[model samples]
Target chain A: MTTNFSRFEGTEDYIVSEDLRNSVNVAVALSKPLLLKGEPGTGKTLLAQSIAKALGLQLIIWNIKSTTKAQDGLYVYDTVQRLYDTQFGNKDVSDIKQYIKLGKLGEAFTSEQQVVLLIDEIDKADLEFPNDLLWELDVMNFHIPETSETITAKNRPIVIITSNAEKELPDPFLRRCIFHYISFPEADMMEQIIKVHYPDLENTLLNEALKAFYWIRSQHNLHKKPSTSELLDWVQALSAGGISPDHIYQELPFLGTLLKKNQDFDTILRRVHNRGTGENQQTGTRIFRNW
Target chain B: MFINFFYLLKREGVPVSITEWMTLMEALSKGMAASSLTSFYYLARAILVKSETNFDKYDLAFSKYFQGIETPAQISDQVLNWLENSLPPLDMNIDLEERLKYQLENLDLNELKKTFEERLKEQKAEHHGGSKWVGTGGTSPFGHSGYHPGGIRVGGASLRRSAVKVAGERKYYEFRGDETLGVRQFEVALRKLRQFTTRLEGPKDLLDLDTTISETCNNAGKLKLVWTRPSKNSVKVILLMDSGGSMGPYYRLCNQLFTAVNKTTQFKSMEIYYFHNCVYDQLYLTPTCRQSESIKTEEFLRTHNSDHKLIFVGDATMAPSELTEVNGIIDWGMTNDEPGLTWLERLAHHFPHNVWLNPVAETYWESSSSYTIQLIKKVFPMFELTVDGLEQAVKKLKVRQ
Candidate 1:
């Protein structure tokens, strides 16, 4: 079973480069889960939705929490509720199917139509979580002990997993998937991405904003660099605030949008202020400021 | 034919399992990656190489197996052009090899920097396969793609690992310490440090259905659901990590441990602080904080209770005087009446359960001449920064009086 998937055209907002499109196509054709790893806010999660939309597949998302278990992804047996009703409440205990709920992964597997199973932030879950899905993901079937029946996918789901590399996934689990690293967009790519969100923003303003964005990102001592999503947010805020290219220095207060961490903001602001005042003592620092 | 490739990868420490091997074979058989060597390379890597840490190792193993397979060295076109250009004839006979070798071995960093500048100005042409010019091959003290005992590599690939200084903008990423660890390894290792107990909260935590069903059956059909949340690891941990300078090499491992511990809600409270080579009179909350914003070491100790666990992450490769003598700090200028040993002992005493995590291998510490490592071992039980080492350290920290 293979997906006759092609590159998402620019008609849709999913403007992906040829390399990424090919990676997705290969993953889809191979029926292997596509695992996306990148910096935060670089659209790791958004890529799943774009792929699903482009391929015309139903999307089933499982946003993982720290306490999320792999069992929760398969099926959760509400034995506590069932027992409670069996003891106190006069409820129908005839059917065990009512007590057993199919989780996001379970739902995707049981669905007759092809679906996209997005296991977002797999790194957020406990380390063993990914390994638990290994057998089911590879074989496309899982057994429910209570029901004494097996649930298998009628059409193999296109699984898309995203990780921030917060914690390393097991090698066994990673081996079962297709991997791609979504690097921060370069100049031309960033322009297209920004235009997707803010279409009417003037060319000069956008150019100046990108220049500042890249300049601040180039700072070696920054705690966390601003990602592509932050760039869009910054440009949107600038456009709404009627900021011009020449007056960008005055809009330094809006830098909080770009630099999320307090230390990063403070460091950048301090350096900029020092450089403006000609108080930078080091020649290396002065050269960086100029660049 | 490609089974040998799998063995080579396994030997290179790539942990390629049989299933992944079969998958690669299947991929090739299906013409999924049979188009070209590059396609096959990507398909095999995507199927077999699991983590980013093993990518370089895979490249090396692949090159070894395929014989002439190159992973595209990062040397620039400009540098390549410069290196390809033949230099005008210069003095061919210069017997400065022994003297240069001695200087490379004995010269201090300050003298090395001086020599680098002098050589940069003296060498005018791009000399290839020569003994003097900073180009590829031969025995030059500079340039890439060549052989020299200790020369500054300009922009070429590393030949002998003797370059004192690399003259270019190289992208440095944090080293991933837990890259090879299995899933749930850290969490399982951290289970040894679970010292807190919890009361039953609700069914939201984790439903005790077996107990609930048994109790209900005994009570003549009265529903009693048992629920409980694992008490958060209530142990207070004051992690004092050394940052900057020598700490740069161990940054990724330190960061991995920090992130892993921070994400777990097992701790009652966790406080992290950064210091330079040695924990002097104070420590900064963040790396970017100035000295004025730092917390006094005395005050910090007083604030955290005596029971707080102190895990110091550092290489512990510093001058002996930094720990034993007053005002021995090499980076900052300050007059300290008390030595670093005194501060460390004071901390160890305040926190009875304390462990020092050294990124440097234990064998290196045993052979090192630095007395700081010796004093640290005497003051606190030291562990390597590896996963097993951390597990052992956690086990030691859990030991009660």
Candidate 2:
């Protein structure tokens, strides 16, 4: 089963760590679903798109909600539509296959070329949703009782399942997939990620912003710590506002871009205020004002 | 091919099944690891370890197995050099090689490597410790420690191994669930509270297929469709939390649980109330337990039905009189005609589905001397405030009276 498939080295937009890259390649090579878990905004969903881009495969995303059922991903029998057709007396309603619409998973399986099928935030669905999809995922096929038809994959789509760790996925479902937890990037990796978003960001400003950003994240009392996406937005805001490097750490311009919750904002503000007071005592200059 | 490592991982508490092992083997055969040790570490982990919670254990097991292989070979060379040059003439009289051999045979290489790595990270300077850290003049595991079997002498010329360094990092320790629970984890656990009920009454949105088919047949060649509302989680929860004083330590934990319960959209309704030490005549709406935010317990019970799952979060550690005697409420201004125990019993009786989650450890409960905890346990099923305990409590809540 050693097929000559090009390995996913991450797309230009996404900067993947060595371990993550290896996990992706291994999952691809073995033709198993890659389960990506991480803190929110660590690019679990983006990785699937990156893989699709890198491998030149079409991307199929199944965004799961609380009401999402496993069967919905495969196919939906539009019985109401069939009944409407029968009542209106327009077209022949005898063909059951006509009303059977292919869903995201079904489309991915039926695609002429291989695709990247992203089951984004699988945990958003009900607890049993993953268990329901186990058979289809393992065999790359599903059976429709209405049509008495088995929809098998023309090409087994590379499956990428992302989880927010909201629900603990069943063990049997987990056993069938390759799992990787994307750790939040360190300062150096964050720099690369920042550069990916803002290519021409000034080095001094970037350094000062990153320093303050990391310092805020390190605070234990924060209810919701700012993540990578927030940092990108903050940097974008910084450059657009033409905020100077010296004022970046002192003023913390557009801090609302980073910390979302009022509690987190207050926590950071208090700490920064205390530090700024101490610095003022030493330097005899008001470095910060209460936001 | 690293079969022992599989058992090692299992022994280290990572649940590595045969199916996952087979997948890893297949990957290896396909050159997925690319003949690199680091890649193999990652590839094996990605395949065998399904959760980040087990990643730390996997690292330990991987390092133990691989480092064990490399340790003895390197140790022998170091031992030989130390035996020749480092040993004093007077000490040589005690058959040094024989002693060294015996010590080497008994020493756990895995333990030694782990201790060495820990010592290397922790030890800032020379200090006295008993065979644990890197220091002299004691039975320290590293750096010319006097008379220790598994001592790795520091300042000796040794080759730096990349694999050991990778394992030493222990990056995934933060993800371990043994510590305080994240809100997401609490939400996951709380999701079990969802008792979905498909009400016949209300807005008809979903298509009732079976009814539609039967109706179509009755209509005689005419098509008909049946619409009905989908099943929704109808479980209502009433949370009574013990706030202030002793609960100060568990403030963050309670907050997380509260956040999780608030975040979970599964429940039909959720009502939260706060109390100090134990519930008396009134329950406060806020954690501060102020008079302004108070609600009469009798009124609360009368309004809410017995179908609500009543959850009590408390340490349940207080003076026996507080639960037993009349006017035993902790607050200075407040006065209760009845004891705290009676109030608890009344609430428990009112809501058939009731559970008490003690922030204190379960082990402590068994040996607890607190009369209040024992008294409360009789009224409501007491469980520790942990992931497992919360899950069990949720299960207990779902069961019919």
Q: Please name the candidate that would achieve the greatest lDDT relative to the true structure.
A: 2
Q: State how far residue A114 of model 2 sits from its true place (Å).
A: 0.4
B370 Cα displacement, candidate 2 (Å): 5.0
The residue ranges of model 2 lying beyond 4 angstroms of the native Cα positions read A1-6, A279-291, B69-164, B179-202, B209-221, B243-264, B287-293, B332-334, B352-370, B381-401
TM-score of each: 0.73, 0.79
Give the docking tier of candidate 2. Answer: acceptable
- lDDT tens digits, residues B105-176, model 1? 775644544565565556555668776655776666656666566565666445455653321312112322
lDDT of 2 by residue, B1-401 (tens): 88999898989889889999899888888877767777788889999998888888887788678755333323333333332333211122256547655766788766777766655555554454344544443444454424455555543322222122465345677666544476757877898788778973579898898898899899995877788899988989999998758887887888888888887877888989998888988989987777888999899988998999999999999888889989988888678899888988898888999899998988777565866787888889999898889999999998753
Find the candidate with the highest TM-score and give its number. 2
lDDT of 2 at A194: 92
Give the best candidate by DockQ: 2
| DockQ versus reference, model 2 | 0.37
**Candidate 1 accuracy as lDDT:** 0.74
